[model samples]
Target: MDRTPANDTWFQGKAARSIHEDQLKKVELFNGRAAMIGFVIGVITEGLTGQGILHQIGLGPLVDGYATCSVQMLPFCF
Candidate 1:
């Protein structure tokens, strides 16, 4: 039985596409992780800095804005 040349090319294209999709998924995962770390760092820094500034300004050091978020939604994970 002779293998069709077009079938070989199709399989090669499919394999390449699969690899591309995997790479895309990896990049997306990395970006998500980076964003999470950055958000945590930013929140901590902002809380500290704002508390200091508010204290200097004679206002209350702790405020109610710490629990706010940009993309507010129901708890996703915890």
Candidate 2:
């Protein structure tokens, strides 16, 4: 294992060696916090609107439209 300048530079350039464990931990913590916040927001929205998260986002109609079209052989639904 020679510690020459070129070898050191090459090792540094490697993706596996570039990212530190501490950076990954930070990213994980940030993602966890974001998910928690999003879940709280969704719950609040559901409570206020009396609808689940998907319904609040207007996916309910889209999904129902597809189901109805499929079942009844309709051309389109919205």
Candidate 3:
């Protein structure tokens, strides 16, 4: 293959495509890591603030209902 300017131009397109693909992969990786880190921070903050899971999701009554059902089912389990 002759090292001509035309050949260089042809290779440039392929190089640009590979560079673009690498950049996109990097962006995706960064976004995924950022989301995971943010989630961990949020969970840690919530825990430090002393907010229980039921209270956090406004499902306090649901837990009470579950407790009641468990009590009712205790006899059946035996």
Candidate 4:
């Protein structure tokens, strides 16, 4: 069997499509990971700085109380 220009063109098209699909998958994975990392960092930064949603919604005091209680309870359990 002899390879012709038409066959070569078709093969090239398929290869291009496969390459495009692989690249798209990589981009999607990268975007998802980046978004997750950004969200985690934002939450941590907000929690540490004490200016995030928790503080804005008045949950900060409740959380602080819970933390304090936990610390107080540790000595009794031992």
Choose the strongest candidate by TM-score.
4
Give the range of the ten consecutive residues with the poorest summed lDDT in model 1: 61-70
**What clash pairs does model 4 have?**
none
Between candidates 1 and 2, which one is better according to TM-score? Answer: 1
Candidate 3, 4-51: lDDT as tens digits: 999999899999999999999999999999999977876886789776
Error of 1 at 54 (Å): 16
What is the per-residue lDDT of model 4 for residues 4-56, given as tens digits with 9 covering 90 to 100?
Answer: 99999999999999999999999999999999998788788787886775665
TM-score (C-alpha) between model 4 and the true structure: 0.61
Model 4 C-alpha RMSD to native: 7.3
lDDT of 2 by residue, 1-78 (tens): 798999987887785655766688899999999999999999999999888788877798876667667645566554
Report the error of model 1 at residue 26, Å: 0.6
Lowest-scoring 10 consecutive residues by lDDT in candidate 2? Answer: 69-78
Task: Give candidate 1 regions above 4 Å deviation.
Answer: 51-78
In angstroms, the error of model 4 at 2 is: 3.9
Instruction: Give the range where candidate 3 is weakest over 10 consecutive residues by summed lDDT.
Output: 69-78
lDDT per residue, candidate 1, 5-50, as tens digits? 9988998999999999999999999999999997777677668775
Ranking by TM-score: 4, 1, 2, 3
TM-score for all models, in order of appearance: 0.60, 0.55, 0.53, 0.61
RMSD of 1: 10.2
lDDT of 2: 0.81
Instruction: Give the distance in Å from residue 9's predicted Cα in candidate 1 to where it truly belongs.
Output: 0.8
Q: Residue 57 of candidate 1: its Cα lDDT? A: 46
